[model samples]
Target: MGCCTQKCQQISTFTIAAILLGVGISMAILWNNIFINIRNKQLSVAHDTQGFKMWKETPIPMYMEFYLFNWTNANEFMNNKWPTKPNFQECGPYTYSEHHIREQLTFNENDTITYKTRKIWKFLPEKSKGKLDDKITTINTILASVADTVKDKNIIVQEGINFFIKEKSEPFILTRTAEEFLFKGYDDPFIELAHKLHIKGLDIPFDKFGWFYDRNNSVDYDGVLNMYSGVEDINKLGRMHSWNYKSQLDYYPGECGRVRGTSGELWYPPLDNEVLEVFSPDICGTVKIRKNGTILHYGIKGNKYVAAPEIFDYTEPQNQCYLPKGVHLDNGVRSVQKCKFNAPAYVSFPHFYSADPSYYAGITGMKPDPAEHHFYLALEPITGLPLKVHAALQVNILLQNVKGIDVLKNVKSTYFPMLWFKQTAELTEELSSLGKLLLIMPSAGTYTAYGMIAFGALLLTIGFYLMFKKGWKTIHDEEQLLNQQQTFN
Candidate 1:
């Protein structure tokens, strides 16, 4: 009876100890969680944190806004990454630069559609190479007569005109040829103006990085030239951008055609006087560095790197837009030191040249994976008025109406072809190959934190298991010792 009573007491004590251990462990884990939350909450308000670490389970596309740099004293703003860092954010020459992207749609009031067409040069869809008819004979006679007159006979540069004058459409009954016209200099008054500005003449040696463009632009990105004054003039000239007088949407290199070329102040290609005239306007983003393309930033008052917050909500039509990603006040993004509120004075090359798409940038340089959207596109800045975050921006995709007749005559009618596309997809495809500059914004409260309840339970269970095992072992050992002692006794 005495032994039974003692054994009951021991069992009762061991059970109580295990229960206490489990309870204490559970409470301690709970306290740790509370402390961590409190600490994080405090850190979030302060600006010391670097970037956002939250997992975006569902990143909804939102409309956004941005503001142009309007401050008069904005030039003093250093780190304007023009040409220095020629992604989208940093500034550079305004050519066929298609880098930078977002994930919202922006319907621009100014993005009006105008008449335009693209030219192509296919692998001679037909074997129609050299066809000479009445037009060709007349043209050759005129050329030979003209060539006999000019002192610089070799300069009778007859290219786009005679080459494309096929049998059916050859008009302009052979009144002119390469040797006839008085050859003059390329009509670029802007080059003189550029010289006036202290901005260094862009003298790139061959295709050096950052110094020159790798011939990767619209031959017309500089300007499209038209040689013939006739309607079928464009047919004679090579569109120089895409393959031919088609495929205008294909401005990017490689797929449609991304050959190599030089950037900045390209000399006239031996005047294909066939190029009756060249389409060049005062290169808008190129005056006093203002003519240079700009890297933009709507960096929030304090948060420079976090994606620009909602310029406006996506629920309704808005006046905001998504600026290009990577545009920041830090790490070298620039502002438009001068926004020419007044349009410049230049010829109307209505076909290819346009300064309209300079307003905003869609996303670029990213992959088209759904899971990779945020990683590639989340580089936004807080926008002010006149700017908004949008993926599908109603902005000019290409300066239109510049093909065919337009190219031959070199029209400049501000024909920006503002269009729309999936903003994030475009950006990811462009920037997927670029180095990223992500900012870590520590959340005051993790909006998507998982509860640590399971971890607490696990710890508590382990604590109790250890205690119970020790107690059971002690009790068994005592019983075994008593049995041996009784036998000896």
Candidate 2:
């Protein structure tokens, strides 16, 4: 009975060891192949998922810092007694806290959601370098836009508009407070007169003139957007289906007209070393950015993408569509005239960074530095979440001699630097910790599986050793008993 019990004990030990070994291998396989994929799926922008909650209303703290170019020699230039080049003095980083919210979400059956974006901006006086009431002298946008509009009209009509401009004594250069040049907006007699006269080209939507006038806390400014919800297809998350209920825009032709790319708010996961496209409503088009390198944010690795050098390169075949007809723009500047209500407005990198040198040839005081003016985005590749963003854009206006307009007849044609702004956001400490946890959980699970496997192997080895030793002892005892019997015989 003792022998049978020992044998049964050894068998039971081997059985347990084998079971543990098999279980450890199986668990490792499941954890790596099945469970990991499921966990990633849960992170998709599906309804009721954590990603969806975050996308519905952004929790990241965002800021917009405006830097206006104070033209130092506007008077000399307007009087045609200026030097060879125009001089500009960089002014202010008027900072504002930006808040974004997606309103009126309508989830469709086709795995898409239609929504409108409402952005609210609050001025941060403490963060700003200059007060809003600080005086600034720049080009009179009203006079410039009016001259550009009627430049092609009948000669009589041109003279008639010119007569009105001269009679009103509209200054080619106007002085206003910084607030009037940005969000607060200043009233112009030309704006009222154009509206009263029902001028075709000068009929603007707003009564006041400002760079971002009537845009604060406005939902209608950024038109309706229809994007994928990522429920059925995770790769399509945040990908735009239509903007303002249209798949294409009339502002540009060919591929430039397509309403594609993400809304710069979210991106699809599992990003490889590829170009990323962001749809910017402010520019009324898509911007292509490529991976520059890698960056570490809060101890987590991220891919950094910057605007491609060919973004505004007219020589490139893809960007040829962005060039306006009959407009000979240099490689650096992109005309947003059609999108900006025919105002001859253009956009470039801050201080024309990465732009063609010709853009700043006729101007002085433009210092383009990669650290301050470049636009870049850092994203965590696994979750496709933005880790850091620096979106910088400069607004410029083209001035040229317009026929019959006395103020512009002798004006040297140049791209006038107006203002540039940098919209920035970064992952906060609390959010970074949460992101770190998400990244750590998978590795922790993998390590736990490895530990289980190792422990199971150790148990199997110990069980085999004990069984072998017990068998050897039993055999030795039998041999010794046989020897004793032989000696007694």
Q: Considering every candidate listed, which one attains the maximal TM-score?
A: 2
lDDT of each: 0.23, 0.85
- Count clashing residue pairs per candidate: 101, 0
lDDT (10s digit) by residue, model 2, range 219-241: 88888999988777878878999
Cα error, residue 432 of model 1, in Å, equals 14
lDDT score, candidate 1, position 478: 83
Candidate 1, 400-451: lDDT as tens digits: 1212321223222221221112222122322222212221222211221222
RMSD (Cα, Å) of candidate 2?
A: 4.9
Candidate 2 C-alpha error for residue 132, in Å: 0.4
Worst lDDT 10-window in candidate 1? 50-59
Candidate number of the best lDDT: 2
The parts of candidate 2 lying over 4 Å away from their true place are: 1-19, 33-39, 77-83, 201-203, 464-489
Assess candidate 2 and give its TM-score to the true structure: 0.90
Tell me each candidate's TM-score.
0.22, 0.90
